[model samples]
Target: MMVLPFLVAGWIFLVGVYGMVTSRNAIHAIGCLAVAQSSTYVLLLTVGYRRAATAPYFTDTPLRTRVVDPVVQALALTDVVVGATVTASLLALALQVRKRHGTVDPDALTGLRG
Candidate 1:
């Protein structure tokens, strides 16, 4: 059970990497990069998950029972925000590249050098 999440995350990462590598369009590559970034969230969530764990609230439940780690969830949220920011920035850059070059093809981007 513990290994399943890791395997899934690895598979997602590989698929995203393959997409990026095989993509001809800059926008497509950026999307693939975002997909690659999503694997981190899965890994973090999986790491934070605890079987039969309850919320950290001080309800009728005792303090000794299993409770998932809040820190990892927070980290995952932070990662998501960072990923969104990066994706937005990359997309904007890609748009600019497309406007300047009139094409989003990676191979035709050689003339973009300074």
Candidate 2:
């Protein structure tokens, strides 16, 4: 199997994490979180990829033909959906934070009240 895709995914994940760690604003952190979540799509696709493999549709292929894994593809799709949902939720929460606190800076919101 090729190692490049895995390396690329890892690099992307690290970049996102670094961005999240250094981000000051809540919106920026949410964007970084989404970027981090996106790396899973690349990882899943890389894991499911097969050289010279056809699509997962088995309607016309022979019994022994190589086909990419459908499960991983499904998982990647699910990851995308979940990522979008999480991002949206975080964005909404950030909006609420800005509305209530008048700022989205992480350092400025240290005294959050319940």
Candidate 3:
């Protein structure tokens, strides 16, 4: 029960990579990259989970002292921002490619040249 999500996330990450590699269109490849990025987030959150740990936020309960790991959560937040920036940049490039070549096909865009 506890580790299932981790396993699933790992598989999802692999599948996303496969999709990205096999996709001919640049936009589809970018979508696969986003899926892979999401899998990393799932892995991060899954690894940070602890059984019987208290919520991340402070609580008034007298006996509850455990706190959810904040460092991993913060790292995940940073990763999300980085992924967003990368995706945005990639999409902009894809748009340029589409405008120049009239297609999003990476197979057709770059042929022995920039």
Instruction: Using lDDT, rank the candidates from best to worst.
Output: 2, 1, 3
lDDT tens digits, residue span 3-109, model 3: 79889899999988999999998999998999898898888888888878877776674565777798889988998999999999999999987887898986676
* Candidate that beats the other on lDDT, 2 or 3, i.e. the better one: 2
Order candidates by TM-score, high to low. 2, 1, 3
| TM-score of each model, in listed order | 0.92, 0.96, 0.86
Off by over 4 Å in 3: 59-64, 111-114
CA shift of 43, model 2, Å: 0.6
- Compose the digit string of candidate 2's lDDT tens values, residues 7-114: 999998999999999999999999998998898999999999999999999888999999999999999999999999999999999999999889999889967845
- What tens digits encode model 1's per-residue C-alpha lDDT throughout 17-110? 9999999998999999999999999999999999999876666877588898989989999999999999999999999988888999988888
Candidate lDDT scores, in order, read 0.92, 0.93, 0.86
Error of 2 at 12 (Å): 0.4
Q: After superposition, which runs of candidate 2 have C-alpha atoms over 4 Å from their true positions? A: none
